[model samples]
Target: MNAEKPPGSKQALVIIGMHRSGTSATTGALRCLGVDLGNRLYKGHEGINDKGYFEHSDLADANDEALSALGSSWDDILLRQENWWKREELIPFAARIRSHIRKDFANSSIWAVKDPRVCRLLPWWLEIFDSERISPRFIFVIRSPHAVFRSLERRDGFSMEKSFLLWSLHYLEAEQWSRNFPRAFVDFDRFIEHPAQELARVEETLGISFPISVENAAPCLNQFLSRDLRHHQERESPESSPVLSLTHALHQSLLGAVDSGQPDSLEMDALWNKMESIQSGFPRALVEHIRSSGSIQGNLQITMNRLMRSWSWYTGKPVRFLERLAGRNV
Candidate 1:
């Protein structure tokens, strides 16, 4: 954290979006604008996300633990229950979040945190923010559901149907939770094509300014928001398919509202209803399949680790004996 306060310093910027939906790029762009992402950032995996995730590790871990307490994980489409905020378990999680803020962001005036898991956990975070007297600004990044589905398939081995539902679940939660806060929506495709314009819109809409000038930020933006970074591009509009039409409609509506500077709650509510209707009919078999696969994968990994340990233990003496023999022969 920097000692000096920058112009238009916000208390915190929370970037909310589904996984593989350009949250990392949005966070990286904000970092260029001089938003502190705290000292401990998730470097992100090499092949999956060569560019950094820009999410604080302590906060992210806390969110993971919080999700687990709520009977959810990052991969689960069904996040917390409707009344999750009232759960007694969240009390400790909120305390942990407060400690993390004190430890990681104590010296910063304007810091940002981005994690896809935060989409569903906003209620928990909001409680902490209110208790701690921290004002939060939100940035929601949305990509076409088709693109998100493809990316999830390649990365997580998720089925197209499961991915679509997960994307819908995340965005629905984000929209519902973030309505009270000052928020700006960035279309991932448009942001990639014209990052400066989108970021400028975010600044103006949120009533915050970047610490650095657009000229300085431009170079960093170029380095971060390149076309090659986008792994999945929608071949046809998501609206063209029945499975993705609701997501596409909701995303377009949110984007329109953000651009017009007035988000329509009634329209958003209607969209949510429609989405819920569709999701009600989502196949239970698919959900079970995904969960079963995950369990099998975890079990296989544990079995492999046990086997490797056993092999090492059994072969240790013989290997050492062979090494001594080789040394004597030499």
Candidate 2:
């Protein structure tokens, strides 16, 4: 796999992160910098992210279908297959994305692709980018797991533990898979606090330029990253459990890399290995805990159904078991 860019290939700014971790805001900033997003987009609404997603809905839907083909969706982090990217089902979706890149952005010098699903789908996308001959520079958005959980809690009604676990698993895979790419981590909290400082650093690292400086794009940035756009900020810093400790460790390491303008993989590699070894037990434990009480079960059943449908593929459990578990108290 020659990862080098082809002579006439375009530059692709691949914006990735777990859902609600500010990928939207970061991509919106890219738009403010004169990067072409796409013709069709899923515009943000009053209740959701009013700043707009800056994402291609067709591509997002393709990602969802591809994940479903693999028995996992964006939120079903634990249920994804080991080495899933190599599966035959992803080829069609990869072709779709690659074709979009070739046709949609053919004239573009650089364009941005913003989708949380891209974090998990990087292996397929890396190959796609290579095949398309486009050079991809990644921006991994980071946010406090607790704060993200609060956002998910209000919006999706996800349990705190599930959200934290998703944060750990999602980024662990994203960082590991994107290790070889030209990439930079951006702390969304701080990025919103001071866009100019963070983006200046990001531009310096990627050898890519955003047409307008963050300072120059002040009015656009202000409108996109409004005070209300940032809804949650986790103040408590205690690591209450081994898993939370690991989550915090990943969060800190990402921010530390941002702080120092250096990317480190050794620590993240260890965290990924740990998460993999223990995650099979994690789903069972979380499910049993959710089932232990009848009240929480009712509150979580719909969300659990949405996430659990395809998880059976990963745990070697029958699909019926998860179906029953999701449908009933036991």
Candidate 3:
């Protein structure tokens, strides 16, 4: 076996995957393995993700802005051209990311950054890394489509088909975007079941051994990767659409890739090509609006109208009082 990473290793482990796909969990596991995940991670909600998100909020916010600058968002099923991340609007954010790396991980080595958004924003990150002379290794998390759907449905009210589409886009794009880089895939279930085995696989692929062994980190992993932490179990469900069938197949391939150490894009190439061809029509206009706003438009509009009415009543109160006094004097 190879020696563990030294104190001077500049390896940045980039963890990417679709939301509700265990990217957070993988990040947590990596943290237990002695990866520096920074101090500004997102807070964990009670029922949603009690073990903490393990996502760097700063990078996550910048990622949101990068997507917004392109008139896209995390939930939008549409993917922009690779050049979109190169736009002027994204430059400042890229610089911010660079500054963040310099300041936060100044004395650290073998630090990890985990954000599901990175699955789509890898192109931008690659450019940033090139300028910083930093090396990046990718770890993609995979979960069952049905489990992801159930989790997203509970958290975001997303439909099954929409969940399938988002899952496909994130995974396929992450795979395509990071093809040239050092990357590995881990199944969420397997990681939870046997984190030591998964970490060994990661070490083999990424060429960097963790400072701490999984055996040493067993206490932490046992607590963090509890069965309760995984809210949804993998329930095999029928795929109603051809696109969904492709998504399901892609997911299965990812699970296989975990063992084979190859995503086997040869078989997935046609499926991804077809997915991109038909993606424009998957989430229709109204659906796109919902994704961008992060809520249902009709409900939001109704809430706005009520606020306006209340404001109108408050502003008109003095005038109504004056009118009433004038009438009484008359």
Candidate 4:
């Protein structure tokens, strides 16, 4: 397969999915398939993801800051506030994002950026893309809610109930926003079991080819995509909670669409609406406020630091005068 880009075609691959959903594995596979993952990557943390997380650190930090500015966090479920992206406040951050792209991927024709936060902050990135006149192809990775929850429990100490809710929120937002772009959804379970077939599907769906043969990339892939890494095995036909059932249905639907190469917009909408209805009573406003408090605390700290410094400068003369008086007495 030819890995070279067609003449004058500037494209990017943006991997959008929930955390612990095999996003890192998918990004690593893409890298093996000739996709440039930029220079500065997040080395996977020990005891969590020993295989390096193929995410850009700066981009991930920027996304966290952006979410903080919006009074949200990475774990926030109600982050998709309407028209938040169009706010004037995001302009500066957008400029920074553009700078990051230019700095990290200066010479590459086709590169990728993967941060689970991107699933929520997609509109902001889409605006940057539109203004910069760059087109992005998206690779959305999905996994069973049960497996994802199990992983989150082990990694983040999250409860299964909260994990299920977060899983639903992330995938729903990802599906809703990514519909307008060129995208392909990959099943993580299938991918781990059959890397070549899944990678080939990604290539055909996105109209790109790997730079090297699959045989060559096999060793690299094996290092990361192993059975031990897949610690959470999904139970066969196990009983699911209501939230899990809903998310599982959504997962199956997306997988079916991917296999058929056609997305069922109506079905997706119906499932999303069902989820929204069920979660209508959640304390979204309160949660948003609580999440935003982090940003407030951050800003308050900065202000307090400056105030202390200023007070020290102004009181320096008075303190020195007292010191001279005490010296004379002594």
Scored by TM-score, the top model is 3
lDDT of 4 by residue, 1-330 (tens): 001121334578889778888888889887886788887776766667787889886677677667767776777655355688877776777788899988877677688999888877877787677666667788888787778888888878997777877888787777777776677888888888889888888878978767765677888777767766666887544656777677777878878877887458888788788877776766868766766775775455445435534657557757766887889431
Q: Write the per-residue lDDT of candidate 1 for residues 187-220, one digit (tens) a residue.
A: 8888888999988998888888678866688988
- 10 residues in a row with least lDDT, candidate 2: 290-299
**Per-candidate local distance difference test:** 0.75, 0.75, 0.78, 0.75
Model 3, stretches more than 4 Å misplaced?
1-9, 280-330
lDDT of 2: 0.75
TM-score of predicted model 3?
Answer: 0.83
Candidate 3 lDDT by residue in tens digits, 220-312: 877778666678987877546876788878988888888888778787787687787776565577656655674343234335435534767
List of clashing residue pairs for candidate 3: none
After superposition, the stretches of candidate 2 with alpha carbons farther than 4 Å from their true spots are: 1-8, 237-239, 282-330
TM-score of each: 0.80, 0.81, 0.83, 0.81
lDDT of 2 by residue, 1-330 (tens): 113443435788988688888888888888888788888787685677886878886687677767666655567646355677899978898888877776788988779899887877777877787777777888889888888988899998997777888888778777777666677889888898888788888888888977777678878877777656678878665548667777888888888977776557678778877777767566677745433442343335434433534455336446656777799533
- Candidate 2 Cα RMSD after full superposition onto the native fold (Å): 9.6
Sort by TM-score, best first: what order?
Answer: 3, 4, 2, 1
